[model samples]
Target: MVTERLPAKISEKSEEKKIAPASPIGIFDSGVGGLTVLAEIMRQLPNEDVIYIADSARVPYGGRPPEEIIKINQELIPYLIDQGVKLIIMACGTSSSIAYPVLKDKYKVHIIGLIEPGVRAALSATRSGTIGVIATAGTIHSQAYQKTLQSMKKTGLPAGREIKIAAEACPLFVPLIEGGFIETEETRKVAKEYLKPLLKEEIDTLILGCTHYPHLVKVLNALTGGKVVLVDPAEEAVAEAKGLLQKAGTMKGKTFPPRYEYLVTGSVAQFQDVGSRLLGKLITHARQARLPTPERSDGGQVHLPLK
Candidate 1:
């Protein structure tokens, strides 16, 4: 169930307020793709409130310049923090690859990106020490997953066995998924061409590197014929979040129904329609939100409005 309401005014002296256990977990993405992550979070951490921000106005961050991605995140991250979220999840592969490393340490709230979790999961699932990753061009260009896998391969797998990694950039997947073309023959055709190289490499494990790629699981599975293990990084990322919250003693109590707030920087009607279809539940309402202007104050902080 979803409902629309005005956001409460957040105090300017936000730093003074402690992020309590009951504070909402914030998740943001380039667009509706992040709903994949949100689904895992809901299944695993049902009692916690969630504030999801979809930067659909700038959807498809895949091919953007690195500087532009960072700038866009500079606006979105602080806006989420201002909403009083206790933690933030970088649910977009492009952002996770390009912006996360640059911005993670600068923020006060804990930020979890999809790369590390994905690399770890792929390593765990690869019995043959051969893995393939498919994501957006920006993510592939950044070489985030490839580098991480290379670095961790020695320790993650048996000593003598080497890890073979094949990475591909499937830029069309996002547009197809966002356009609500999940199971179409065109999607299957595109996916088949994309997976051909990885299949030729005989990879035993495949990482659905983009959050948007999970929606194409049916096509993916059919293409692989149940021979390859598929890893959805959202599962590991949410599990890591659960572990961190538990260790920090900040898991929300099961005393009440969890609140789910949806905000977008684009069309509410479109987001609701596609999001509902992807999530298999009606997104009855989603409030439209704007990012704080890029101008920074003397202390180098983005000035967010109280409302």
Candidate 2:
């Protein structure tokens, strides 16, 4: 419940006025991985406009230090707020695990992370007491999923039934997925090796801990022989967002087609190329975003370019 204060400019803008339901919902990740979350949002809340940011320039947040990850989010959140988004989703597993706790109540806007929803779904899907989580190294190292499962299982599962959690960090997943190697045999072989340990534990439920892992559903489903239930946090997160919007009366009306804007800190063409395939749709509106540089030597505030 700790809240970190935002910069004066951002705080004033975000808190000074009521956010409209028609404003876009913001979603972001280090790279194309967040498209999985975007896909779910589009499917479940088709009436809400979406603005998605891909910080591909700083791709693979999994390996970054906690301080660096927090700093990166500080930049990304303000930028999204500047765009007048009503809510924000931290769609990256590394960010959800490492940065979300630090920044959760800090911003005026409602920020939803992927961890809790995925954990809830995994807990519900497990027929046995065994569950597996596969995510990036940073997420696994954070112990976010494992801890949540343990804490929730105490009340959520049958009494006296021991819960076993197995976690594996698949570091190579983001690169392979971002490179558009979803259904290749090479990717399949790598996935099998990565999943071997969890399968050894005989886990009946597997959480797709990283957003990018959802893109490899076919490979993972094939490897697990359709026995292990794969939980995609994106679906649950979107469902949660939809419920919150409805309860708050902030759900957008069905007056027009929802607008979709794509922004990336890296190459626009590359993101469009890989992202289009992953989302199973053509991306005709992607553009590069020039984020503000880190704090200046004199401690002056940096400003983003006007949209």
lDDT of 1 at 40: 96
Task: Point out where model 2 deviates above 4 Å.
Answer: 1-17, 294-307
Model 1 regions lying over 4 Å from their true place:
1-16, 291-307
- Highest lDDT, which number? 1
- The weakest ten consecutive residues by lDDT in model 2 span 296-305
> In candidate 2, what are the lDDT values of residues 61-89, reduced to their tens digit?
88777777887788788878878888999
For each candidate, give its TM-score against the true structure.
0.90, 0.90
Candidate 1 structure quality by residue, lDDT tens digits, 159-238: 88888889899999987887889999999999999999999999999999899999998899999998999999999999
Worst 10 residues of 1 by lDDT: 3-12
What shift in Å separates residue 11 of candidate 1 from its native position after superposition?
A: 14
In candidate 1, how many clashes are counted? 0
